[model samples]
Target chain A: MLRELFNSENSVLYHVGKFVMWQKEIYKKPENWSMYYKEIVRQMYDIGIGSLTIVMIISLFIGAVTAVQFSYQLSGGLIPEYYIGYVVRDMTIIELAATITCLVLAGKVGSNMAAEIGGMRQKEHIDAMEVMGVNTSAYIIMPKIIAAIIVIPLLVSLSAIVGIMGGYLASIATGSVTEADYIKGLRSFFVPYNVLMMYVKAFVFAFILTSVSCYQGYFVKGGSIELGEASTRAVVYSDILILVADFIIALVLTS
Target chain B: MIRVEKIHKSFGEQEVLKGIDFTFETGKTNLIIGKSGAGKTVLLKLLVGLMKPTKGKVWYDKLDFVNLSKEELQSLRMDVGMLFQGNALFDSLTVEENIRFPLDMFSKKMSIDEKQERVNTCLAKVELEGVNHKYPSEISGGMQKRVGIARAIVLNPKYLFCDEPNSGLDPKTAITIDELISNITKEFNITTVINTHDMNSVMEIGENICLLHQGKLAWQGSKEAVLDSSNETLTDFIFASPFLKKLRNAAAG
Candidate 1:
């Protein structure tokens, strides 16, 4: 039992050390700034415009549900009806928009990254680049991380606005609250720091998802079955890391 | 010239290459021929610095490749080109884009027109002139291999490594590829190393051949000596098939 425990611990440490070393290689000075810029532009288009619709859909529903549920809980209570909008606003901004939307993207974008890079590895494309003196890690992965960090936060901000709109639409449509009351709730007691917190969370989660997915894909070996497993692992690991980062960011930034 | 000294490689407990020492002469087609699991690919990878040897030193013309710093290695790699067995063409890029990738990444001083001219020259050298805009999937496998060769030589590298350059092609195309590599080797006088198990390649363009058997250098000789030599291991590998053995016997008679 002790030996098994030691072996497992060693495995974990080995992977952690490898992961850190991989990050160091990825951030090395690029060979050509223009080439990296072009890749970053392509990645921005892929991560940003490609992911807009899904983010809109999820954020809207999450806000609507929050509003409706808050309304139900406050029914016949002395608490004001407009509090539903406040609850939706704070929940969407402080947590849901950045965290949940990124969790979904961890499935969509993260898995795509893993499969693409892992396929490159399997096909020897990475080897070809390595031979040509291209820094495969920096060339392939850095742009992806940069693009994600730039775009995912923009996506989260958009989600926050759409979510608020969703909550407003839900409350006014259901006749549970007046428009003036909902607007008042949105305006009342707004903390700008919460928006800062949202952006911080978005950035951290974006880094986690992109870096973890790229790491998984960059080092992948074997054939198709292994590629598929890497894709799945990218999503699973990115989601787990995003949640963990979410908690830590909440503790650090919010405090 | 590229040389490996006392090269050894291992994966955990299993040793893949056990003390390989050889020199690949400049302006010659050097072949590393081996059966499956004979560490041909591992040695190729080590020479290219894609994988480090468990124990050995690789010298690229007096520079210790095994001990170069990361920046130094990258600089050294700029002068090296390689063709993978699968061709390794970027699937999404067009033929022109694929061929021009090395230039775009490394040749910062060259203008777009100069780069285009260079790409054209490489394509023409490979006999692939009119297929620039087509994707890899649209091209035939032979054309793709030619494109891969075109891409590898675009920068006029000092060293060229080809891993099974003729694996998936017809015999005629395989010979064409061998001749192309040979012509390029002589034309530019680049040190060329090919890792292949194809017996035909050994007889056709192998100026210097090193046969690996089960992790050791089994035989070293020229193509002229291959047919006449009585090395048991070489004979066994070359005549592994009964039909080839019969053909060899008939040819000998």
Candidate 2:
């Protein structure tokens, strides 16, 4: 009879409230600065270097596909050939590079974070740390989130560059655009504001993916099967939230 | 010493610990024994501040644990050390790193050389010397358990909690762990509490015992009291097998 009033924990609003409240725990002063520094370095290496190859691969393919499709669309229209380069560059910078790259990372880095933390939770490592007076939330979650915030933006930038190059190579190789025309298009309508938008989206998506994933793993209970579910949910929720945030960011930033 | 004043814990509709009032004495191996699902783990967690009580207060000496602020709780937790049921050694870290983690995290005044020396000293204490660089998976189960002990005592904590320290070990290793815990507690003069169902642990190093039955304290006393007490719950738990009953009868005769 008394449980229902206090325990509508299943609602989405409840989880959001909990997540918002949990932020305070994550922002507490560290027990030792050097320890957090070391952890941040380790997490930086793992999240940055670990996902580099996959990010580059997906970015290249996305760039190539965008260029090819844009060329085909422009063929029947009065749009100039160089507009392919302009469209690909703006598209990669404003949306594709940030969104797709993070979505991929949501699968790669997000799931990995979930499994690592979930495994620690199952093994009682988190409890052991808690007993030692280390802020498990700060020590565990902050490093990953910080590292992601720093590196994911850098990764998105790289993805943008690689994607542009992919567009160049795909269009020129397929006789869709000449090198001179493509180069001219790349130089045309270049907006520095689009670059800022990319960074904004990168920062937002990075926070979403890492924080959401870490949250899923941190609060996990029960056994191996539950751990697996948490890992999957980390990726799933991260992707969904990324898309939603992308829409909202697009609305706000473009407005 | 840690004292629970009228502690009661419940999970939704089910109450797991019903008014468990007890004090775990300092420098003694205080054991909480019970059958599976009898709430030994729940009680241990409550004592360690991992879980809060549904009602009543947990007193860690002069401090009230239930009402401690976040910073205060963390401050209090620094003096606490625990050996989890699975040892809970960090798999990614080397054995030395695992043991040295608390020191590394909290011991800002210590030099790297001092930290290394302390880690080595703890290893030697656990008789796990020379395996510093090896990960937890590379070591044997008993050795892992010792590494867990080494990690727990790295800070020379004032309060030590062990939850099933002998859950998976063989008899010989279990005895060794029990002796180590007992010695550590006495040497450091720290209040030690153990939650376990291992009878061997109960008879060997259980200077103080707490037997929980269906979330209530069924029996509490010294290790010597187990042999003389005619408590049905304790008897049924200790002499559940006929072989043990026969041995008890023969010894009595």
- DockQ for the candidates, in order: 0.89, 0.85
lDDT of 1 by residue, A96-136 (tens): 99999999999999999999999999999999999998889
Model 1 has a DockQ score of 0.89
TM-score of each model's B chain? Answer: 0.98, 0.98
Per-candidate TM vs. native? 0.97, 0.97
lDDT of 1 at A61: 90
Clash numbers, per candidate = 0, 0
lDDT score, residue B77, model 1? 83
**Top candidate when judged by DockQ against the true structure:** 1
Cα lDDT for residue A129, candidate 1: 95
Best by lDDT: 1
lDDT of 2 by residue, A1-255 (tens): 445434577667667877899999999888888888888999999988998999998899889999999999999799999998899899999999999999999999999999999999998999988888888999999989999999999999999999999999999899999998888899999989999999999999999999999999999999999999999999999999999999999999989
lDDT of 2 at A241: 98
Candidate 2 chain A weakest lDDT stretch, 10 residues: A1-10
